[model samples]
Target: MASDMESDIALHLKADYFDFFDLSIEKIIGSGSTGDVVLAVHNTYPDINRAVKRFSLKEEDLQKRNISLERVKKLFYHEVEMVRDLDHPNIVRRSNGIVCPGYLAIAMDYCPLGTLVDHLKKMTSERIDKFFPGVVAGVEYLHSLRIVHGDIKLQNIFINADNEAVLGDFGVSFKMPENVQGVKSVGSTMGYFAPEVLKKKPSVDPFKCDSYAVGVVLRCLVKRRRPGYTSDYMEEIRSTKMEDKFRYFLERLLCRDPCKRSTMSEVQRSLIEFTPDRYTLELSRKRCLEDISNSSMPQQKKPTHKRSASSSS
Candidate 1:
C-alpha cells in the first residue's frame, strides 16, 4: 500500500493545490522564504493562489545528531496532522498534504504582501497602528483553536496585498492537552525564547511561551529598534511597573509569571483600541516602502515597444 501511494504521488509531481480542489495552477504572483522552500503557486483554473511548503528533514544538524530517519518522518507526519485540524482565517489554511517516495509536503494559502519582519524593517513608528491589528487578530484566532504556535516571530507573519496579516509557519505548532507538561526546545529561536524556557522550569505552559515571543515581536515592530543583549533598553521591559499603554502591553506579554500575562483575546482587544493618528500611519508607510525599494531585490525593467516592419522579408 505504501508503494502504491508513492506511485500515486509521483504521478502528481507538478500538480497544484487547486488541482485537488478541482481548479488549475497558473497565476502564481510571488515567491519567498527559500529557507523553508515556501513558494506561491497559483491556480489558473480558478484564478486563485496558495502557498506550498515542501518539508524535508535533510538538515545537516539533525543528520549530524544521527537521528533515525523514521523519527524524522514521524515529526513531519505530526506537523501535517496538526495543520490539517486547524481552521482559522488569521492562520494560513492548509489545503492538502502529499507524500512522495521519501518526502512530504503541504499546501496552504499565500500572502503576497511580504513578511511582517520585512515590513517592520521599513516602517516608522507612525505606520505601526494601522498594520499591527491584523497581526494581533491572527494570533488571537490561533489561540482560539487551542493550538500553541510555538514560533510566533516577525518572519512567520505574512502580509497580503490588501495589507491583511496572516500567520504562517506552523512547523513547530501543537495542540495543548489539559494537564500537559512543556516541550523542550521544540521550536524556539535564540534570544526570543521566554525566560522560563531558558531556565528549563518545570510545568512551563506552551501557550505562555508563545505569548512571550509575541511580546518580543511586538516590541521589535513598535520600536523599530533592535535591542541587543546588554542594552539598557531591555531594562524598560524587565522593570514593568510603568503605565504607558504600549509599555504596559509589553510588560503583560513578557511577564515572569504566566498567570499574570494577558491572554491572546485580551491582546487582540487592546490592539484594536490603541489606534495611532493618521499622520503617523502615512509617514511610517512611506518610510517602509522606501526601505523596501532600496533592498537587494532587483528593480523591474521598463517595457519597450518596437516596430514590426522587418517581417516583410
Candidate 2:
C-alpha cells in the first residue's frame, strides 16, 4: 500500500536539509499553538500546494511559560511521525516534514474550499447524510489503529478539493492504551465533550466521547449552530427535528452512558446498511460548487490573522 501510494504521489519530503528557500510562501493561512500554517508551493512541485505548519520557539520564552523545549520538540516529532505515515483518503495526507535550522515544519495538502464549517450555512437536510459516511470512515480508520482523536469537532474537519470531509489537526491524537476500559483524555474543545468527559471522570471510554462528538459535529453541519454546553446541546438535539431513524441513531450516539453509546463501527455499519439516496450525493456536490462559485466572484483578498490552535489545519 505504501509503495502504491508512493507511485501516485511524486513529492515525498523528509526531515533533513530541505531547502526552505525553495518554498514560495503565498500567505500565512492560520496560526496555532505550535506555529503558523503558511500556504506555500515548492519550486520543484508547484502542483502540490501545501499548508506548512512551522514550529519555532525560544528557550527563554519556554522558560517564561514554564514549558520544556525538549518536551515540546518530542511531541512535535511524535505528531509528524504519526501523521506522516498514515494512508487514508478521508484523512489529510502529510506531504513533508522539514527539520531545517530554526525550523520544524509539517506540510499537508491545502484544501481550498475551507472546512466543513464553511459549508454549514447551506447544508441541506440530506447533505449531512452525504458527509456522514465519509466522516465515519475517517474516524473509523483512526480507531482501527487504536488512535483516539481527543479533539473531533467543526474546526478540525477540513473539506478537500473534491468537497469531501477529511480529518486534520492530530496534535492531540494518541494511541489508545491496551486497557480498552479507557484512556486519559488529553486535548479537547468544550462544546463537543461528552457528559462523562465533562465531569473529568477517572475512567471513561474515549471512543464514546468521540462518537458523541461526531453526533455533535453532524448536527452542527446542518444546523449551522455551534453547541454551547454539553447539557444544553443535548436538549437542543432532542428538540431538533430530523428523520426518526437518524434521530434514534443519534440517541444511540449521544447516550450519556458510554457502555450504551454506539461505537463508530456500529454507526458505520448502520449507515452502510440503510444507505441514503445516491442522488443526494451528487446534489450535495452540485450545491457545494454552486456555493463556491457564487462566493468566488469579485475576489476579495482578506488580511491574514493569527489564531491560536492546538494544531494546524
Query: Cα deviation of 181 in candidate 1 (Å)?
Result: 6.4
| Candidate 2 deviant stretches above 4 angstroms | 1-21, 43-45, 59-68, 277-313
lDDT of 2: 0.74
Worst 10 residues of 1 by lDDT: 301-310
| Model 2's TM-score against the true structure | 0.77
Q: Model 1 compared with the native: what TM-score?
A: 0.67
User: How well is each residue in 116-195 modelled by candidate 1, as lDDT tens digits?
Assistant: 76676677555565556666777777777778888887778778666776787776788876666566644467656777
Residue 144 local lDDT, model 2: 91
When superposed on Cα atoms, how far off is each prediction in RMSD? 18.3, 16.6
lDDT of 2 by residue, 1-313 (tens): 2244433333334433235447688888777676678888777887867888876656665665565767656656667656876889889976565655565677789988787777878887677766778888999999898887888988888888888888888887878767666765644788888888767888778877888888888767646777666533556667888776667667888787778889999998888555756457767988899689758855653433123222334
